[model samples]
Target: MSETIAFIGLGNMGTPIAKNLIASGYTVKLYNRSPEKVKGLVALGGHSASTIGEAVKSADIVITMLSDDHAVNAVSEEILPALKRGSIHLSMSTIKADTSKQLAEKHEARGAVYLASPVMGRPPAAEARQLFILLSGDAAAKEKVKPVLSAISQRTFDFGDAPYTSHTVKLMMNFMIFTIVELLSEVMLMAEKSGIDKNILLDTMLNTIYGAPVVKIYGPLIIKEEDNPNGFGTQLANKDLRLAQETASEVGAQLPLAEVVRTHFEAIIAAGGGKKDLPMLVSYLREQSEEVVK
Candidate 1:
């Protein structure tokens, strides 16, 4: 608990993660562009900083949990100039693998280290410290951040020395989640139209086939259509999907189904569901299936 930590980007997930760090007896400096967010954490034994540089400058480790690539990149610029030698930038954002590689190179040039340690979980899971953390980068840097990782996650999967490997896995994980969302959406539509009882479909899914935790979680959400409060919003879901294809393009890989799922996301957004939770894709797909029958 001797190490000082700076947590930037106080979104849903970031807030709880930062609070857990403070609760774990680490000194936490909190920062957000909107001072209001900083205030909330400040009430919970966190120190507030008005700027990213001010938050991270003296800290032993700087953690970023921003929304996407642009936000992560903008903060990395400020972090590079202020981070001291041997310090760590624990980037927990769901960003591009290329961005992680680029950030690691820049940090190394400045005598600092970047660890692409993004996590998989919702805000509630973050609050419970049950996230599955993914880490990949320099051996020493990864070693240094072990305490911080332990404080925030139930398990850490080391993706090896290449920093980009972690992000690749993170994106692939999210892509798989979205594919489940897409599949659950379409299958639920068919089930409803075919008069398959909702409980029966869920029971069969959980018992017979496709019963991973991700499937177990979303199956009922799609059946009940419970996307309220936005566990995974459209903007971020679409951003991850887009990042998947962009990453695929970088290596000449194909993601045909991902491409189609993104189109459905676009159509949902265009129809004024931009702010809706991702499971709303079921409703979107249902409307389309109805049209085909007509």
Candidate 2:
């Protein structure tokens, strides 16, 4: 018999990941705060549980893809008491390293296993099962969950015994992603101000040394001034940046660029772009330049 899995948090990324698991032949139980969100999963032959506790009660593995530390903490606390001993809880959210470590200890104390397996990819990547997962946990626990991880991600990078390691690495990765967005925004604005067409500038850049998938994928969205149709919303990006800054502060490390990026995102939120795609920062950049011209 196959191991039954429970997936909590049926958001943009989680939904597709669960769907892929079902397709890959896992018996999946799903729970979402918004009950309506699980309806589609039920239609597709997955079971739906009314609560987190009910969802994980009989499962061998539980995966969470919550929004932030608060949600992760709350759900873990709520479900920890109900999870069977020795069952694994895999966290796939971008949270602070300290929180991940604390959760690991807390869950382990309850005779349950915890693994930090934060993923790197957007919704599209999740839908395609092309995500890169960073995992850190007990070797045995990691091995047991490998099949489920394999179903949702193209590759999993194991960081070994320390569960919080994956969370720290995820924060650093997001810091780089945010920095790229900020730099792209500023440079695009500079080019536009200098009478250069945004698209042409992006094309030239893509043909040069600095070009990569990040630029190739986000450049057009930035240049077109299309802020709607969110892939990854600004609020989530801001939350991750704040977590990264907090992590740096705790370690006595200076993250000057991260601070700047956080401020830029905060300003974008203040300007009502909180619900927009993060690439919308380029719109903020263009507006600032236009104001300078006035």
Candidate 3:
């Protein structure tokens, strides 16, 4: 589409997504809070911008993959002023729906297009360009960036034209994943304490009706007590869960299980498992059980 992209936020997921865009022959201007990450991308033929305004000024498409709502808000200060009219501001962060709606309104008022394009996949999937993207925003702007999205995602699913819809979908998807992880931890621990083989049970469930990506991908990690080396830490998971809980409450929907899962993640973070992977929820359950027994 002959677009220049300003890629912001060079964390695990952003790093590879930006790499994929560079690989796709897009002229990318890279910006990060950390210079080391920008240097790494520069080595791969990306242009480094000294400031967010510099990155957003000459870009046709500005993409933000920040960590949270606050990070996105801070970046917007630099981007909104320097962003060219008619440019597309694509947000790929897992942020709150209200945050996205606010951004969309501000972008529209500024004559820019804002899109919510939250993704579903871990860092490995992003690195491999196999992440599933959920998109919602101005239809014309979406079409303009379709090729760019294709370059970095396995598939892009449209959720109509409401910018917040994509964020809602992403949060719900995350809630389901976290709930499953919580349930799996409980079941796997119970099986272990009852003298049942976790590996055999997980294998059986994985090959049966419960053979979904969530179980198959995370089951082994929990069983082997492996940490999440790529995806996300418990703290981030808890944040997403809290977003989901807030979203559900806003819509007047009940999510009792999400509330329970949120507490589990909160406890995990309080116990200093915040930086550990999501699979460590299983380990946390095991430790708590051991403490009770003691």
Candidate 4:
């Protein structure tokens, strides 16, 4: 018999990941704080649970894709006790490294395995099963969930046995992502201000050194000022940046660039762009500059 899986936190990223498991021939038990999302997943042939405890009671694998540390901690309170012995709790959320360490210890104490496997992709990537998973935990537990991880992501990068390792790497990646977006915003804003077409500038940059996925995929969106239509909100980006700052402080690392990016995002959220996309920081820049792009 196949292992039964419980999926909690059915947000934009979690919903599609759970759907992929169902499509890949796994039994999925879903739990979401909002009944509507749970119903939607059930409509796709998933089993629903009224609470987190009910969701993980009989599952071999439990995956959480919560928003932040608070949500993950709240759900873990109910899930830790309910999970069976030798089961695996896969956390796919971007959280603090310290929280990951704390959760890993708790799972170990309960005879449950904890894997920090946060992903690096948006909702579209999740839907396409093209997410790049950053995973760290017990080697045996990582192998045990290979099938489920493969079903939901394009590739999984291992980061040794320390569960908090993945969270640290994830924060580093977020710091780079937001920093790039901030850098692009400054240059693109300058391009528009200098009487150059923003699209043309982006095209030139894409054909040159900035030809990576970050530029090719997000550059156009930033240029178009696409809001958080894909579910990656500014507040969420701000939260991740804060996580990076905290991690840096813990390790005595200086992140001057991250600090600048955080300031821009903070201003963006303050001006009511919290629900907007991270790429839309250009709009916030334009507001502060009070200059026409064209």
TM-score of every model versus the real structure? 0.96, 0.95, 0.97, 0.96
Per-residue lDDT tens digits for candidate 2, residues 1-294, read 299999999998899999999888889999999999899988888999988999999989999999999999999988898899999999999999888889989988989999999998878889999999999999999999888899999999989899899999999998888898888889988888789998888899999866887888778878876765538788889998888889989999978998788887888888777888878888777777778889
Q: Please give, for residues 1-294, the per-residue lDDT of candidate 1 as tens digits.
A: 899999998888998899899999999998898889888778878999878889988999999999988999998889899898889999999988888889999999989888899999888789999999999999988888898889988999999999889898898899999998898888888888889897788888888887898887788888888776638888778889999999888899988989888999888888777778877889888888879889
Ranked candidates (lDDT, high to low): 3, 4, 2, 1
Give the higher-lDDT candidate: 1 or 2.
Answer: 2
Model 3 over residues 1-294: C-alpha lDDT tens digits? 478999999998999999999989999999999988998789988999999999999999999998889999989988999989999998999999899989999999889999999999889889999999999999999999989999999899999899889999999999999998898989999999999999999988988869999898788888888785666888888888888888889999989998788887888888777888988888788888999999
Model 1 TM-score is 0.96
* TM-score, cand. 4: 0.96
**Of 1 and 2, the candidate ranking higher by TM-score:** 1
Q: Which is superior by TM-score, 1 or 3?
A: 3
Tell me how far the alpha carbon of residue 97 in candidate 2 is from the true structure, in angstroms, after superposition: 1.2
lDDT of each: 0.88, 0.89, 0.90, 0.90
- lDDT (tens digit, per residue) of candidate 4 on 1-294: 298999998888998999999888888999998878888778778999988889899999999999999999999999999989999999999999899999999999999999999999989999999999999999999999999999989999999999879989998998888888888888898888898898989989988878878777788888888776666788999999898988899899988898788888888788777888888888888777884534
Q: Tell me how many residue pairs clash in candidate 1.
A: 0
Candidate 1 deviant stretches above 4 angstroms? none
